[model samples]
Target chain A: MLSPILEFFSSDPKDKKLKKAVEHIIGQKPSNIMLYRLAFMHSSVSKETVAKGYKESNERLEFLGDSVLGMITAEYLFKKFPFKDEGFLTEIRSRMVSRESLNGVARKIGLDKLVEYDGNRRTVLARTSMYGDALEALIGAIYLDKGFQFTRKFIVKSILTQHFDIDTVVSNNPNFKSLVIEWAQREGKQIRFDISEEGAKHNKEFTATIYVDDDSFAVGQGYSKKKAEQTAAMKACEKLEIS
Target chain B: MLSPILEFFSSDPKDKKLKKAVEHIIGQKPSNIMLYRLAFMHSSVSKETVAKGYKESNERLEFLGDSVLGMITAEYLFKKFPFKDEGFLTEIRSRMVSRESLNGVARKIGLDKLVEYDGNRRTVLARTSMYGDALEALIGAIYLDKGFQFTRKFIVKSILTQHFDIDTVVSNNPNFKSLVIEWAQREGKQIRFDISEEGAKHNKEFTATIYVDDDSFAVGQGYSKKKAEQTAAMKACEKLEIS
Candidate 1:
């Protein structure tokens, strides 16, 4: 086990830039570099797996890593704010794990150089989620290769402790849905969110409108209905000066 | 480290019902009974922690275990349905992890006997989600006691392989929101979901309605807007005979 782990990490003893960088980023020597290799494999390339019936992409790992990341962050917040209710914890969690937030964090951690997407990396459109997905895949790879405790430690030492300020995150209010509803109730007005799917199957966009007393107050769009509703609520809050 | 692990598992030389049941369920000697103790602790009896200003409940563990469970299931589904898209994967996952399903699985696995919630176990109203939360806590405990590999094996062998039929879960469409929208679109009818908050801050209930061509068609309620939308969609589907 030791021999294979070391050999895999030191395969290119002459030039181990990827391995060295990965080790530095994750704060440990790589056990199975192949997992890390797959972490860098973007869906665009979608390289075929050595396993006969498998296609290798970071998507599955991304999905896994997403949950891992959420758990770590949830644990952190749960400990830091012991008195905070579930709603507050959940809202802050959303802000911390949002695509925009993750994208920014990925860039801050210099994941742009490590990703393997099959497109120009410099385009503004491509930059929308440039390294966010790869970062998640890396977390998944680390979880798979290192285990949960090690992954949790990496999230704490490498990501949270080093990259993010937990205090700022906890202090901010991100639950616009609650805010708009509260405003509506206080003013004795009824508010409703009308959400509908409006796009292609794979890239479906949901449109949500915040309706005040059967009239449209604000409109917002997102990849999912919940996301669209949140955006729409934020827009309504802003429009009504309640934000 | 090995000695300490062994000692922790074997410390309680007496009433080892918890340890025995856990060992039997997990198919291995638990490394830490303390973790299992925390797993059985419901919020009603939230024991204070040794850590200053910290309270111990199964909540944090539940949060962690949820991610562990999600990751394991996601990996399983990803492998099983390599051709399926993200939407399909997400829909199938919901069915597998729904409260109703979890509750049933928990009862089937005898978590009812192991859980330590401070309530009458015979009450039907209290049975709404008695064992599901404890089941998650148990998974979290197993993860903490034996680590991710052990947890993964336990989920696969003890839970999925022994308990659930993956084929049935995959084949059934659980995303009523999607189904209702599809049916409405095929019929050229304008469909909308009106989601609004109702009730107290802590005991908040969300109400959702399915509107077809500006007419109220169905109503559903849940703890969150997304769940409310889903319930409303399911009701609409049933009402229109599209489900």
Candidate 2:
């Protein structure tokens, strides 16, 4: 029962280019045809087939893949940076899992080669998050077909260790919010955040004040509290001349 | 610095009787300090840590964990239930990660034992999503502390396999949206979703109609697409006696 369904989704074995690409990227012959199919299935096809009580898209797979990626990424960070605390680990994980990074990885893996679409190029172009979404879906599919261990190995070897630097990436990107608070407490100062007004309602602005005991030493404003604090901290760092 | 901090968080080692209860329920030693902390870090923590230099709480962690939990749960369903398709996998994952399920886990693990606040308990009670939020944060922390294999082992062995069955869950809790769409299409129907009026400009009410070709089978209303669809779908489901 599953054989013909698998055959329907699988690329022809004779398609040398796709086969080679799959072999190079996945490092083995494809065993799970439905996963590959789900990775490339578009929502339009899903909508049509959904009416027939037959699911036809990668959305579910994408949802599954997202978790797998996060778990694998978290695990990798845990072992790689044992000395770092939870806050430090979290910042690094955020950068690694950010939409920009995920999209970059998807493009590097030549995922564009496998995309099956039925619309104008503009339509595909408009759906920018498609790459990241599909990549996540593919990871979900891989985990389903193979297993957690295999998925973790594939993610570590293919994505984390290969494409990104562990230390340089994290250390350079310290959490500004944490730094600002640390500096305030160390100098025996009080800090105030006034999110009174800035930006539109959807994008509000915040202003932060760093006071050394009784006097305000620095002030900064930005779209988010973290950004505002970073600005304020950078200003205070200059005034304190701690470096 | 780190040792003292660890001691401060983990001292008392979770009361012996309570620990035994948690072991019987969650089936593991507390995975890591951050997981325990996150389970208690309420949004009321004001988003700024004097030591950490930021005003953000575990909200971001909760966001990341929510998506990650969804993905991993979906993959678990996919592998465990080979006969089940995308819809079934989605339904099972939804149930596993639902607010109620997460709250049940949180209560079982004695998350309330670690809260650090002195506000009206009713205010805390109102935010039902907090339970799921804490659960996700715990997962995120575990992934950071333990790594992929251990985290996977913990989640699968401790949570899903121990507490629930995938097939029964999916068969019982069919997604209302999917069911409605399937039924509408089978009966040769068209659905129209219209935003009739918005409340306060910020909060909006949407109306959705499930039409059998041209005849309206069901009409429902809500504040968001998902909510509106669920309402419409529920109406259609009850009308058709599908479940």
Candidate 2, residue A207: how far the Cα is off, in Å: 12
lDDT of 2: 0.63
TM-score of each: 0.63, 0.54
Q: Rate the local accuracy (lDDT) of all candidates.
A: 0.73, 0.63
lDDT of 1 by residue, B58-145 (tens): 7667766776787788777767776653435655776787778888888888887877765643474365565777788788888777
Candidate 2, residues A1-243: lDDT per residue as tens digits? 336566656567634455566667878765666567668665434532423333457766776787788767766775675444344555577788777788888889988667665454446454567777778888877877787778888999999988898767766764455676777788566775443454345545577776656556677765467666777776565444332
lDDT per residue (tens digit) for residues A1-243 in model 1: 345457564657533777797887887888778778778877556644445434567777787788779878877776777655343566677777778788888888878878776664347337566478888889988988887789989888877777678788776755789998888888789888888884346546578999888877788765568877887887676455454
Off by over 4 Å in 2: A1-12, A15-17, A41-51, A55-57, A74-103, A119-129, A161-243, B1-22, B28-68, B77-101, B108-110, B114-134, B137-243
Predicted structure with the largest DockQ when compared to the true one: 1
Native-to-model Cα distance after best TM-score fit, residue B109 in candidate 2, in Å? 5.2
Q: What is the fnat of candidate 2?
A: 0.21
Q: Fraction of true contacts reproduced, model 1?
A: 0.35
In model 1, how large is the Cα lDDT of residue A107? 84
